[model samples]
Target: MGPTEWTAREEVGVGPWSGEWPADDRYDPDLLAGGDRRNVMDAYRYWRREAIVADVDRRRHPFHVAIENFQHDHNIGTVVRTANAFAAAAVHIVGRRRWNRRGAMVTDRYQHLEHHPDVASLAKFATERGLSIVAVDNTPGAQPVETAVLPRECVLLFGQEGPGLSEEAQASASFVVSIAQFGTTRSINAGVAAGIVMHTWIRHHADLSSAW
Candidate 1:
């Protein structure tokens, strides 16, 4: 089935009283009891919180996502949602411990998130796991992502909207990549840029034949 129709299958189990509360009930019971008004698709409606997270974890991709959060950027939520949709292994927040999740629409429950004090800490985590860290930026030294070879096991890192990337983040990455653009805008929205880089990684590394 195509993406549009993939979730059309009737959800087997959901609704009130179907299951126990998740060990980590990140959501309000009143919210869950009120028909799960969040933005998630129908298949996950009213399911116990942990069930959804477990399902997502089972199918998560090998690639991880890291974003510099020094500015408390509003786009972080959107980036988190997109990462969940793509089934990323985890999301590392560099330079900040908390970010607004309003744009995520509560999808953060299904995405594993890690906090790093700085870019160096994030780089250390990826390196320890043998994953190359690749930064997305438009600096003069950045390679065009469309033509570059992305690693099968790597972390795609991004930065804030106006500044693009921190000097430390760029230095920490094994290589920096840029998305092709012909428009007059100096940069795209950070969330959109993240989606582009993530989809590019999926195309080159994920097994589409097996993706649902």
Candidate 2:
């Protein structure tokens, strides 16, 4: 829906049931009885939060998204939210255990999230999991993501907005690809970059017929 056509979060969604409720276990009795105006899709309007998470987990994407949060970037929330939208296996936050979650719009509750102390730990985790570490940075020697072949199962690493990826983070990457920008801006926002990279991976690997 367009911006003007979109319903306000507080004003949209289902209201409390006035009659008999559905017998499905996935349906939350409280929600069904008392207005489920959550910011969820129509199919999940009255579904239990736990049930929704279980369903999402069952079909999550193979790839993961990670952000080096040494700077406490607000973009991390947007990245996490986008990860949830893309059905990423998980969103990894390195160097920060606590992040601002306002931009996630409660989607974080349905997505898997992990926190690592540093880039090294994150690298080790990816290595042990057999997932490649692919960094997104506009640094030299990096290939253009538009041409580079992304791994089917990889951790797409990102750094903060201004400084970009740390040297160690770049070193930890098995591959680093930059998004092509024609404008005078040296780089794009980490959140926007993450979305672009994830969608690129999806374009190459995801089955379109599976999606609506």
Candidate 3:
């Protein structure tokens, strides 16, 4: 099949339904019955929860995604969705144990998520795995992401919107990379920023010759 073409099993509903559901209502019966209405790509429409997850897992990428959850950032959900879309190896939630998944629109099921008590623990995890940690922030000393050399395997770390990366996060990152911007705004949306970084990794590391 083509990259955008998928053999859908059936049509599912896309609205409210009966009975208890997953914690994040990821498995919307209505959507599952009529087909998922969320922004997921064609390959995953109306598939069973486990089936979608298994498929994503089969082609998972080597890079990991980490976002600082100090404020329980709502954007984290959107980041998860993007990670799932790009088939990231895993997502690391730092600082908090729980985060809002509404933005993910139930796509988290197809993404692997991990939690760390603090930045130190997260740093340790990356170190043990031999994966370098790259923080997304625009500081005086930060390297331009557009020109930086990204590793084939590494963790792209993001901080909460507004506050940006914490001292510990900066300390842990091997280097900080900043996305280029010409607008008056100091920074872009955290979720959107994550998407740019992830795509950059794909362009550099992933084999896209068979993508179509």
Candidate 4:
């Protein structure tokens, strides 16, 4: 017999709820009646926006992610997506309020986001919250992140692509850590670097049993 042709994959998300509707306030009536096509975990399929955020807030990790958006960096969205995946306490966008959300894939809706006008503002926020600022850059005297001890309650700060961290950003940081690279590329983009540092924190502090 000849080999069969491959079938098309099913579309993502569920098409309305079957049987009795859930009475919980967390479930959205619109999503329950209509289909839910939001990019979210299976557990949050029919959840209301606020409910989902509340749920995530309850179990979010202690570490935060911050990115300098001086030039409307495209990597901001990817950084947000990765931050959401790792369940960072929140994502702080410093320097620019607006960023390209295409890479975030709507994950920004579920992730907590804060804005700061400058590096100084971010530093104040970290100080008030008792969080250390660990800047990621390949600047001189920057320790290798792989061997460094990342603080449990700290913000992993990343600079915009190409320019790297601003002088102010680096100065405000409690310390700087660089990701080791074996390739010919001089540096990794902010998005990938954010993911690596966030995962490093997860490995050191997160309770793995809670992971899906």
Candidate 5:
């Protein structure tokens, strides 16, 4: 059977342009003629994909996000999606080249991503870019992220959901932090963990006055 028409069409957005087009080159002709219902914010509606990316790049935060993908963890896609939502400077994937993107909902298209074979290589990239490696996990001796003064410019690293950060990944970090938990769960999901940490960073560092 053929795919459902609604599945192929955007559910809600502006309908086709009725007349003259705008002068801005950033607007995609196709999107303008056929309503733009992309997952993007309304400010970016009808904008060319590259144009939206360029705008995001110009305003992205200094911090970068990195994740260890040793087991092809499905949560990696959620991390990418959150990174995009938070306007992270970039995302670095360490380990397996291929990852599950089902959770990202296509947001990866607007973000910059790099892949490295191992954590060591990711560390090298951090060094070259003057970014400290801040690892996140609930292991012993980890500082509570709520109180710790997170670096404004650094790479926030997360490991696989179950194992958390590996030894090598932990040793390479300039600082390691754990989120406070009252629940009985041993640990939180990687995707949820990433959001909490990112929000903490945002609270301490990001300029809220400019946010939409």
Candidate 6:
């Protein structure tokens, strides 16, 4: 048998305004005239990038997300995407600055990002901001994330794909949390781990009524 074929789906987002245009300053005139095909929510359709970012900053969660980037890990983009989805305060990239953005699906434009030279720098930034550095890894002596008491305001740090947390990164963390796994896999994808950790924080600290 041949592989099943499916019809191509219609393009996402709305076309240009049909009648009178909104007079709001937040609306993007270019997007209004050229159509808004971006991946943003319906509420954000035709909104200017700056306006959307300003709106998000006003209500961003206290928690932040960080990842080690010494190896140019492709998962960084996915982490950014998940952070944006959770409305995290910011994403801190430790080590190398350049990273693949393809997986972010252009959400990086709406997300706040920071760059750090090393784990120590990231720790310092978190400390200055009164945010704890909570590392996510399955190393020994780590608490299970499912039952751990995550800080209400903290930087949830993750490491490279296979190597996990470096010695310096682990040492800088206030505590380490691990996701429980019944399967035999040694570890899950770094991006998937990030999503799980961020969602866990949301469940513990975020106001559910504000979710759209």
Name the candidate that leads on TM-score: 6
- For each candidate in turn, the TM-score is 0.82, 0.93, 0.80, 0.94, 0.94, 0.95
lDDT of 6 by residue, 93-210 (tens): 9999999999999999999999999998998898898999999999999999999989999999999999999999999999999999999999999999999999999999999999
Q: Which clashing pairs does model 4 show?
A: none
180 Cα displacement, candidate 5 (Å) = 0.5
**After TM-score superposition, what is the CA distance of residue 202 in candidate 4 from its true location, in Å?**
0.4
Q: How do the residues 1-212 of candidate 1 rate in per-residue lDDT, one tens digit apiece?
A: 10122233563323332355544454446545543544565666555677678777777889999999998998999999999889999988888788999998777887999999998889889879999999999999899999999998899999997998999999989999998999899999999999999999999988788675
Q: Which is superior by lDDT, 2 or 6?
A: 6
* Per-residue lDDT over 25-138 for candidate 2, one digit per residue giving the tens place of the 0 to 100 score: 998888776677778877787799999999888888899999988878999889988998889999999997888999888889998999999999999999999999999999
The runs of at least 3 residues in candidate 5 whose Cα sits more than 4 Å from the true structure, single-residue gaps closed, are 1-10
Model 5, C-alpha of 2: deviation from truth (Å):
33
Give me the runs in candidate 3 sitting further than 4 Å from their true place.
1-40, 210-212
Q: Give the TM-score of candidate 3.
A: 0.80
In lDDT terms, which candidate is top? 6
Encode model 3's per-residue lDDT on 121-160: one tens digit a residue.
9999999999999999998899998989889789999999
**After superposition, candidate 6 runs with Cα above 4 Å error:** 1-9
Q: Over the stretch 1-212, how does candidate 4's per-residue lDDT look in tens digits? A: 11122233575677778778877899999988876778888888889999999998999999999999999999999999999999999999999899999999999998999999999999999999999999999988999999999999999999999999999999999999999999999999889999999999999999999997
**Higher-scoring candidate on lDDT, 3 or 5:** 5
State each model's CA lDDT, in order: 0.83, 0.89, 0.83, 0.91, 0.90, 0.92
How far residue 168's Cα lies from its native spot in candidate 2, in Å, is: 0.8
